[model samples]
Target chain A: MGARRQPGAGKVLRGLAMRRPLKEAGVLLVIALTATAASWALRPDRLPLRADPAFYRLELDAPLIDPGPALALYDEGQDLFVDTRPAPPGSLPTIPGAVPIRAASFDDDLLDLFDFLAPDDPVILFGDGNLVPVSNIAARLKERGYGNVRILRGGIKAWIKAQGPVTGTASGKEGS
Target chain B: MMRWLGLFCRLAVGGVFVFASWDKLLHPAAFAAAVDHYHLVPYPLLHPMAYALPLLELITGTALILGLCRRGAALIAGCLTVVFMIAIGSALIRGLDITCGCFHTDGGHAVGISLLVRDLVLLVMCWPPLWLADAGPRVPFLCKKD
Candidate 1:
């Protein structure tokens, strides 16, 4: 029987070197995917594989109305103003007659607010100073089929600066 | 000295990854919301990305700390850091006011120049492990014969 020829040392070393990183990457990916699957199966609070389409519908830069125009809307008494802060209604200053809707309690508040609001109602959402809450609540409102939602530019602080009528305490508290 | 530096870099980068993954792994929904603020990820991919990213961080971080595939773990960590820097840079350029979501999902630091600088520091830390051989002992059963 003829003896089989072995591969050269240089070639074997080259192959090993090339394959090592790819193999490491493969292992890394496998471990990650396996752990992700395990988390999904075991964790009660795991996220759904597919996100809600409502999130996609969220406007990255939702329309903004300045404090002056917002105040005018308030005077007209035809628009709905929502306080998107995470505090209790009377704890912080808010535009008078604005419906307090904390993002945490969005669903419950939306149910109550929806009863009085039509999908096409000119709704304005505001937060303390951070636009994150305002934009998020605006997106949620949009998801609920509220068509005319706009965030108040500069939030409640701007409203307070504009001398807009407010309910509860009117002190300009930051990050409420 | 170089070996010790490599070991330190590995642990530091890996520890950050492991630490950052904790809150994200536990609070997938909150992480999803945080990711949403970036507005870069597509809607359908958001949840899956949120789920997978943390697990990747956790496993890669563990591998790095254990000295099992240290180079590979460092590479992945480096790449993830680069991606994060890009995302943060994009957000800043776009003037999007969003939280960094680095450690805590809720009430985390806002995206700013400081966050970018921190990521740059992390990117620097990732290099030593990639270029230098690990000085630590191999993990039993998990590490292959080098």
Candidate 2:
């Protein structure tokens, strides 16, 4: 390809030159800072805990106790098990000595059910297979300053598989 | 036709950004919780970002709407839309059930394909600014040329 030379090309190019994108970027930054400062002033207390790992951790990260260890803890009477599922139908069973703490009733009944337990007492939450309820309950307990909160791994299904004692027919599966 | 369409796009995108920022500005804690639900942001950065993001949205949105450094606002909005798409897409692929913190922090709306598509449309709206030169002679707001 051959380059074509035009008269007064430099002048034409100079006339067509646009402002640098960087200047525009700087303008945007200033505006962004102003808006952020205004928002911050409006809700200074709304800032979240910066380094709190507890608030950031997901449900899966909640400690999971297998059936064997949970049963051992149960036999030793060293831990309290809280079932996060709704009450099972007449055909399905629940873990022996496990207290029912429905997720729906969590906000209202949490203190009532948990007020009797010491802050350091080990608490385990269980459902059928889903860990959401179990994990949430554990988080709630931890939020209320309860230490040593955990979720039952694989829920009541694993408990049944391990032949753990139950209050009703133990063969059926249940949802969280 | 092109210029008018571009103006329309600019105003619409900016208005949306402003609307989205209002709730997050009012409820930083809820926004932070929604950000936490995404599990994409680092723990240490989450709080600061939660505090900062709404302001960014508010500024950029206003810039777009007012035609103040329209290209710059479009750049920011485009980048934000991309980041949101990636976060939402990752959550969908990973099967993490979460509420999208788009307009609400308590999250009545679930994150899904529909939300992603809406963001994509917004992202598309950002194109006119990226591809076209700024209209008029004098720069608005911050950058006034010699």
Per-residue C-alpha lDDT of model 1 across residues B1-146, encoded as one tens digit per residue? 88898888888898999999999987776688788889899988898888899999998898888888877787789889999999999999999999989899867899999999999999999888776655555577666755
lDDT of 1 by residue, A37-147 (tens): 887888754556889766446554467676777898899999888888888878877787889888788889888876678899888888875776788887777787887
Clash counts per candidate, in order, are 0, 0
DockQ of 1: 0.40
**Residue ranges of candidate 1 with Cα displaced over 4 Å:** A1-18, A55-176
lDDT of each: 0.82, 0.75
Backbone clash pairs for candidate 1 read: none
TM-score, model 1 to reference: 0.59
For lDDT, the strongest prediction is 1
- Report the lDDT of model 1 for residue B54: 93
lDDT of 2 at B18: 97
